[model samples]
Target: MSISAPDVTPDVTPNAPWWRSAVLYQIYPRSFQDSDGDGIGDLNGIAARLDYLVDLGVDAIWISPIFPSPMADFGYDVEDYCGIDPRFGTLADFDALLAAAHARGLKILLDFVPNHSSDQHPWFRESRASRTNPKRDWYLWRDAAPDGGVPNNWISDFGGPAWEWDEATGQYYYHAFLKEQPDLNWRNPDVRAAMLDVLRFWFARGVDGFRIDVLWHMVKHADFPDNPLNPAWHVSMGEMHRVLQRHSTDQPEVHAIAGDMRRIADDYSTPGEERVLIGEIYLPLERLMHYYGQDESGVHLPFNFQLIDARWDARTLAQMIADYEAALPPGGWPNWVLGNHDRPRSATKRGAEQARVAAMLLLTLRGTPTLYYGDELGLEDAVIPPDRVQDPRELREPGLGLGRDPVRAPMPWDAGAHAGFSTAEPWLPLGADWRTRNVAAERDDPASMLSLHRALLALRRRHPALGVGQFRLIEAEGDVLAYERVCGDDRIVVALNLGATPHPVILPPGAWRLLLSTTPDPFTDTLAPNQGVILQPER
Candidate 1:
């Protein structure tokens, strides 16, 4: 049965799309929960945890790639887009998981990798079989320079030349990420049709939507020119940042791809069962809006990652939020993300105290919000032993701390061995404090981070103003950042003290009731240090 949006958010129409007011939870499958004692998570593991997510109040779950892959860039290198990897599970297992999720009012979003595929993929194999092969145009390939050097100065995100020599074909192929993950030539009509059909396959399987990986990198310059050097580049930055990527990414042609994707997704939509398309883009807010497409026909949400990289302070965040709101095209819905598989955990970046504050902000802000798995427990970056580091980026760029292993630690379920995540040693390490910070410890504690997240989510469900309403920035100065969410006659205010010192909050003229707070302090004219509160004007 379709989830009744009206049953959750008051005054919401049954016809209204669920995604606009939904809170999405992201599950890094390799780390969420492991079954079969294999020390790696799988589809069944996620199905077993459905009740937990439903209880936590997330409307949907956006899982990272589970398609068959070489695991070179970990699942980003798709070997078979239609089949499920045995490491994760089979197609039947995925079907069962989808049914279980929908039965409990949850939607599932798959990760789509349209820009590239593993070199092992049959398509790539056939394309590289011979230069005269019918599929040679399926991927980006060019002849070596007059000096037999690389075709261009393009650099891979994983470092070194983006072009790799294919001895079999006597040509250089481009890979924006890893050599094993060759870029697909989107310019090829056949490539577009095949990828679009991939979406059709899953949509037919009841997949709710997709979070397209590297949406901006789907198309590159036609001439394959050298990317300009970044004047601000420094040794501290990743080697990819050495170039400005002016001609390599966010190309104008990519917007059309996004539109094509949106049209395919729309074909799968119903009144309340609308499918969503979320693009994983990392660009300036102005340029990012283009993914929304002309007249909002593009991706439903372009993924606002501003919060992930923003300075966790009043002034900086305030300006960013304002700028983002201003930059959004008319009728475009905004979203917020603080942490994900690729970035550091919020607790690791802002400390435990401020992580709670960040949570309050994420939940109370306007538009859709995606919560990373384990964030509700305030999970920090787990300490990875040198031998346990499995991220390819970390292996390639040793000692740079660019590895994502730390943030991708296994979810701490309880105090048992491996923090109850698996029966055997997990693929990655659990946080050292897992014993006390696990879900079993925090589930019943009102003051625990998990409980706080639960309360905020429950609050959003009860108040449309908090979930999908107009936002107005009230004050952003010193240590306090305040905003208001309004819908019809319902009005609520959120205030955060981003510093270690107590900050006085001058509520807008009206009697107000404290709905929730990060700190245990009773409602007063002042907020405790590192505290955040949701308030409503008393009638």
Candidate 2:
């Protein structure tokens, strides 16, 4: 029989920040929902879906970059940091969206691309105009090598050399990602001040927070030394993996920069207006802890992506979670992510059954969980035809399956024309099975993946133990992984069978009642294959 979420409300502390136990939903603006029939999602489109997000039970939404850009790297390359892209909408439209979201008690987070700006940005245009220009030092520029080749051996994240030659200026500029995107010189005091002002601009406009793009890549070694070659690098890896990036990323000075951003966020924090700072960092857990800053003044939440790349097995995931929990600095809150615009979706990486188990693990874990859009409907990677591929990464490196276009497909609202995303043709293709997998189709199905997510999120909100309680690993062996979350008198035991075989549930001596289960079967001593459940002590 199908199980439903119990009617309960969790006790929340009055002064505590909402992000500590909140569920953040990531929205790719171009793909979420299109309002103007332009085949691209705009601010109005997102505003229209605010109720949908509210119904889904997410506390906040983290939208990818929506700033004015040339679309060379989608929205990551910002041309105007302070203005919204025309494709999305005007500033008034954004204000309306923010106000609407806040009205529903939902927070808003915009992607902050501080590491690099579009080549068309006025700052970069002036900096590239002449070497002696006042803004020349605003971006990284260097003279060519003796042989007139590239400046250094640095490689772009897309592929090939990271440096691009400027024929007019006769110098090279650095870009960590695309040649059309120039890296900003954060070492310059004026550049830092300007980027910090960008944060203040949003906070002043009532934006809740920011999800910083490439936070660790902002600071580079002062000497600009060549990165060492990676011995473990293989041909199968991306070209950027050839070098260890020892001097190019994760520099010592980055912490100071993070601290500066944190101070700005704090400046705007009042009793009810608590601004959060989330850094998108992909580093080892040990090094990732430093982003929290000294005295806990750094980024509020450094996005944890270990689950995205971790092995989808019982023991491996359990150990990884423990290690991450142990590595957080004092007073540092934790967050988790299953997928984003850059990586494959959880359902695509693991099968549909395992994805349900993953959803249980994500919401029940002792941290804020960020859910990628479309994963709730159990959407898989869209099949992009060769002619229809839009991702520059895949276009640059074909056949490697590195293209993110598949995961960035349009959100299927219904089975109508273009899956009800837009009247016009979408910029990207929709999934093949949108007819049955769309949100409209699964909204009422009690056993659908969408329903499972709603139930899990409802359960998380109803229990203090699952929200901000202590986490203790009860068992992690073979196909089963069990953990207990205890908050004073409220205690929850989360058990999962990650493998495709039944595993006996091993709980403490106390009698337990099954609160929810991924499978339709009733509570039993054994957990069915690819099943997960939440239990509480029988008082």
Candidate 3:
């Protein structure tokens, strides 16, 4: 059956926080829309599409980095933290987007890059000018090893040594990622003070929150010890994974920094505007929970990426959800992400049908859920011909299937030329099935992927159980995953069939009201392959 997007007002308990159950939609700016036909999506283009996002029933949008940069690593290498890139329009454009989004009951979050600065940034320029420069200690600079080799054997996330030798300064500077991006010295008080002020600059402009980039990598081991080598390391996984990153990330002192960020966000929040800090941490649940801090003075949400890294199986996912639920610290809210720019789309990793089931799992699970762009259309990774590849990762490590360009394709808004994303060619190629898979085509078809997302999002808002409920695994075996979500009087039973052939689930006896089905029409018997449904007491 066709469904309209539901009213997304908070239906949880009166005092419940918005982000606790909020569904955030991550916008890759370059791919979202192009207002001026510059072959790139900009802030003005995003503002033009605020109505579409509101119709999608998401609570907020997390835009990827759009700061001024050389685009060496996209906008992650920030040259100016306070100013918007000329390509993304001026600060006036950002203000307009913020105003438009807020008018629709939606929040906006800017990507905050705190761990590093672009090598071209003024701070880095000064630091590299000479050893005695005032800003020299603002970044990590160390003398070469006794034999004149690079210091400490740390490898860059892109490729090669993390230390870059500067002939002028007679020192090597540390960069965790691309050499163009120099790691900032969070250990230095002046660096800490300046970065925190950057937060204030934005908060004063009325941004709702920040998704801090590489939050764990901000604080490294003080002793500069070499990370222990991993026995299972392979060259294909990138050179940085050669070690376990024990000395580079998940440090104990990072909690204090997280608390400081939370305090900064809290300071600007009014009664209506409860600002938040979401840390982009990739550690295991045990260590990831620490970012929440002991007294709830840390990040509001440390992104949970278990769904992205886990083996796509019924039993494995069931246990992962259970374990993650158990591991959350007191007062720590859980979050889940199916895909992002760095990873392959969930639809590509799993088949198109299973992707719908995965979407069901993401929206109905406990805590906040982040929906990646184009996921609602069952968009998979586009095949980027070698000559057309734009991602440096693929260029640096050829033929490793590590390139992120495929998933960063422009949004297929319509069947028009350029798929209504741009008048000129897109920065990255659109999915091959753009004509059939575009939003305009799917919006009219009752059984289209877009309809299923609308239905599920409607169900999540209509029932409190699915959003802020207590969870319990009901069954997990034989390619079937079942669970119950309960919130006082509201109880929802979600059953998912993971296998290709029809799988019968012995649902507990009850008068069941079918709330939603992954399929278009009502089902009478067993669930079709990759089908899932939400049921409530048929009272």
Candidate 4:
């Protein structure tokens, strides 16, 4: 009897599609690193950390904003769409960062502020020059109220009225964030073309894609009708949330604009690869999927924020998982995010000690996982002094505690002065106990949350089932969450204990083998508190 071995030809390099099995790590640039000793992070700092990112096993990086801005709302307020801020280094620094990133097999995606521009932007300046200016229609401007007051009762996200009175033009300009960040009139053809040109400029510079900021708010009602008031007086940060925002944002026409933006992205695509366009949408699931469009012609991935909204229950987790999987377009890829600069870090939200469990869930989920800066180190929210509050919303609504500055503090890189983030007085104060939570300390400890993250990401890279496999919810009771990831000949069951107490989970009896776990000793036949287990199904 003769035995034959299966023939294995040379593995061809797979074409890298934008959304297929990609892990995107979002870098809040200003808080990521500082190289110029200016007490603020810049592109140079990001370039220096390419190896750190490459070692972490993420496929790509999505940097928040480094574009030229007045820093009114950080970099979300774009002053020059095609230019890099001097504070963040010159355009050459960005080009070098892109080059170095690509060389290290990392793709770079930048934040695109399409919904609005800094009031100081030349276009906005031109628009506000006069009612008859050629660019007067670039931004959303309307006449004063009948009572000679400001426009409508629409509230800005940063607090105060959405419309700002422009004395020179005798009209009010609309801004959904800050008065200085005027909303662009997407209704205007010229404005659309100009925004597209901004995309082209970066694409030509070798940018992989864009994470559109406030994407759903690009289009507003042509009539500029006052938004209906919300009957529910929900309070999160302490401010009275009385105003209803029905008509001001998330308009239906936003989809059409998204489709157009998709077309613009398509124009810049390579042979068979898709250009990435991730929309920063905060709407409910039903409305969120619309950004992808029916035929997958809109945004590549409208961020699924289920983890952000989930309350850490087996039932909630199972249902949200099913709903999100069902909501995707046939070939549409899914993405998961637990934290961002705008929201509280998952560590703080899920209890500082439970951060490991949150990381396990985020990494094992059936989609690209986005890890916010400082999250891997289990960094908690900083305590922002009332006098040092920078967020306009927090200033306006003093009692709400609604500001985002706490979560946007400098990353703890070392135990040195300023945590090695900056030599000068840091822009934001470092978190308390930085000595223990700093990256330097965590890098040396194999049991640290940072090390666990690195191990999980490494495991994810080796297992295709975790990256692009179909997710099946497995049966589990109480706070135990179980799921199976299957891809072709690979299959693995991932069980997670989201509670503080150890939970026993009976495997679907087979040749069960532990693949990975957040617990220090997962293979010891013990499930520790907030432990996670990835078991290979027995053949």
Candidate 5:
């Protein structure tokens, strides 16, 4: 089914500074909508869904990369930073999408991939032409070992050696991801200038901000030292589990570049407007806070991944929350993310019944919250058949189960053929239970998960404490997590039952008033299993 196009007239007035207190919806462009009957979603398809997104009460949309790529790692392996891939759409389609989104008060933030580029990129192509090319320094290249082996112990995110020997240059080029995606050499001044220009190109087009992809891997050690083998190999996530990643990625110099990027955002922001720059960093709390830099000048939001690491236990979650808040810089803005294109959906991670509870916790947290696509309807991960797997990581490391295809399934729009994603067969199949859990079916039922998401988002907007407030942990016992958000005159106490048993918490008499509850049961008496409650001081 084709996505119906919306009116694309441009808006003259400045949009509301809605991103400050608004929810940002993340769209995996390829799975969001299909307008050309090509089985894959395109820019026009996103334009068609702007109304739906606005109706869902999101103030901004963060689209995954649609840049020109070889699809080695989907659009993450960008060949041209300024151009859109034909699989997605042309430049005109993107302009139309931005116009349509702005008309509906929706700000747009495109994904910025500075860590690496496709081997087919012009820069990389020229860099690999010969050892003496002027652009040879644009990409990371190292000499092979004396035995004609890989340079170091570093492992590709997709498994095996991170360095691939280039016969043409008689040297090894580094690829933190698939071999087709070579890591850029940030040490080169010219490379940094070119990437900054790419940022300016999008900013000139009136983009609100950028979701910097793999922002931590932009720089590497100059000596190219070998990474020590990690003894705990099976504990890591994704393709990283295949081998130890010691010397290759996540170098300290990345912060200097991040600070420069922040300066660029500050330069672009108008007096009263905020131009956001968020980093995709997966690290411990102590290390994550450093990405914000010394004076809260670098990376407006470093993306707190505590929720991704915490289990369903109440005490464990409480500690994680406390640790993150404690480590945040004085004026640094905190951001919460429950799921993304790479990880498993929260619905599947936490059971179906607990998804709403998790959502309440996310929206009520004292920071910006990002919701992944299809998460509003509590969509779980789809089981990808082995024969149909397209992830290069899965193909390279069969035993490790490294692919992310299960979590990146097509979004379920309706209970139609291919879940109404496209008239033609989709690149990936829709979830099997799409008929029961979909936007169309949920829109018609007020009790559905989608409706709950809308109501909660609206509620979050109504309460100032949920957006910009001081978070204080409330005293609670086993299986119950409770916290109070206070902003000036507004004070809200949120309690969540992380387990499957009914839990009870003592509250001051007439001091608690039910504001929102994930479970259908009333919040006055006893909290049900897998329930969440937002309580305001009695009126």
Candidate 6:
């Protein structure tokens, strides 16, 4: 049964698309909450916490994959596209969560893994039945090279070659990530038609949008070719960086595929409804902009992760901001993300103080910002001992330190035996400071990270200048970066000192009042070391 449209009009930009300035919060389910004491999170657990999410002030929630899987690469290796994983919940549970979320005026976006599927999927099972099976062309399968070696020089993102030999068949199948995950043959029209129906299944179920994972990897060079060796490749870096992946990713054909996917999503729209499709692409800004498609026919938003890959200092960051803004297509809307399940927590990358400053920069920027779970509480990466590590990346490459276990730890809700996340031991251990760092401890503390986030969110809610205004760079030297956001008469100036020592902000002569600051009460012009502040009416 379909869910009713949200009764309350969402708190969104008056005349603009809802996603333009929406604050999206990502929930990694297993670590979010576990209601059954089974040491894993489920949909019911998420539904239980809907009120908390509302209070946190997010406009939408983007949950990671909850589809049925064999737990090989966690939920990324999906076995069923239309069913919920037994560990996560059943069909009814998801329907309940969707209705409850919409009732709270929060839009929900599901993670769509398009690049590959678990070897156990019904499609893959049927495709591998025989070389001449009716569905044999559903997946990418090629005969062994002339010398009987793996098909090509393609390397898996998880290390080793990208193909796995099948004993029952006289061929090797391609896999971009895990051998258990075989890439789909997207070039096949039948395959494309089948995948389009998958989008329809969820869209008809009332999902507000989809966050397509590995969007660039969906289409690859038709004739398999060796990826060029990276000039900057070093022995110390992850194996994925060893090749440039020129032929393996970001192919020209992908734009058309994206356009088709966007059209399917648009089909579900009603008179006043807009169903968004956000692609999780990590290509360069120049290549990234093309996903928008000609005539606004592609993805609604291709996630911009430049911030995740850039240096933490002001000079490098400022230039990246300018370049990103300049590179957007005429009608392309922008988005930003400070951290996600794939990367280290911002607090761990740049110390706690700077993390607070980053929060300010992310929330006050001109575009939409996606906040990963637990970052709002200033949670640092949990230390995962080698014996307790759960990430496949870390297990596959131990010495390279590619483990994502640290960042995927369970959320700490309060001071409890399991940090109030689960009654049983969590799948991944909780961070060490949960007793003091949990939500309960920080909600009332004026100087805590949680309080700071609430203040910033409150300010953004009240002032369109900070959330959806026009951004203009202000000339500032040294480690300080300054910019102005203006929405008619409601203009605000923001300055940040990325260094460890206090920096004098060179502002035009005027009475600039501090609207919000990382510092304690009684703000001033001299931004304390690693601090960010919001001011009004630039002279």
Better of 3 and 4 by lDDT: 3
lDDT of 6 by residue, 178-218 (tens): 89999998998998988888999999999989999999999
> Which 10-residue window of candidate 6 scores lowest in summed lDDT?
1-10
Candidate 4 per-residue C-alpha lDDT over 187-306 given as tens digits, one digit per residue, 9 for 90 to 100 = 888988888888888888888899999787788878878777767767662322467667777888788878887887888898544578999998888888888886877898898888
Better of 4 and 6 by TM-score: 6
Q: Would you list the clashing residue pairs of candidate 6?
A: none
Question: Tens digit of lDDT per residue, candidate 1, span 1-539?
Answer: 11111111233456658898999999999999998899999999999999999999999999999999989978999999999999999999999999999999999999999999999999999999999898999999999998999988888888788999999879999999899999999999999999999999999999999999999999999998889898998866778888989888999999888889999899999988999999999998889989999997899999999898888878778778777777777778779999999999999999999999999999988889999999999999999999998998888778888899999999999999999899999998888999999999999999999999999999999998987777878754688888888887889999999999988877788899998999987768788899999999887
Clashes of 6: 0
| Residue pairs with backbone overlap in model 3 | 1-520
What TM-score does prediction 3 earn? 0.96
The CA lDDT at 24 in model 2 is 95
Per-prediction TM-score: 0.97, 0.97, 0.96, 0.94, 0.94, 0.96
Residue 165 lDDT, candidate 5, scale 0-100:
90
lDDT of 5 by residue, 1-539 (tens): 11111111211124523455668899999899888898899898889888889888888999999999989888999999999999999999999999899889888999999999999999998998998999999998989898989887788877777889998789999988889999999999999999988888988888889999988878888898877766665544544654444456678888899988888887788844568898998776787888998886688888877797578888888877776776667666668899998888899888888889999998988778999999999999888888878777678877554567877888888988888888888888778799889999999788888988998888877877776666777667888888877767887888999989888876544667887789888776567999999898887
Model 3, 284: alpha-carbon shift in Å? 1.6
- Please give, for residues 1-539, the per-residue lDDT of candidate 3 as tens digits: 11111112333656666787689999999999999878999999999888888778899999999999999999999999999998889999999899989989999999999999999999999999988899999999988899999878678877778899899979898999988999999989999999999999999998999999989999888888888888999978887788778887778877888889999998997755788899999987788888889879889999999999789888878778878877777777778999998999999999898899999999998889999999999999999999999888889888888899999999999999999999999988989999999999998787888988888888888888888877777754678888888887988999898888787776677778788888764544467787898888879
Scored by CA lDDT, what does every candidate get? 0.90, 0.90, 0.87, 0.82, 0.83, 0.87
Badly placed stretches (over 4 Å) of model 3 are 1-13, 520-525
Model 5 bad stretches (over 4 Å): 1-18, 235-239, 242-244
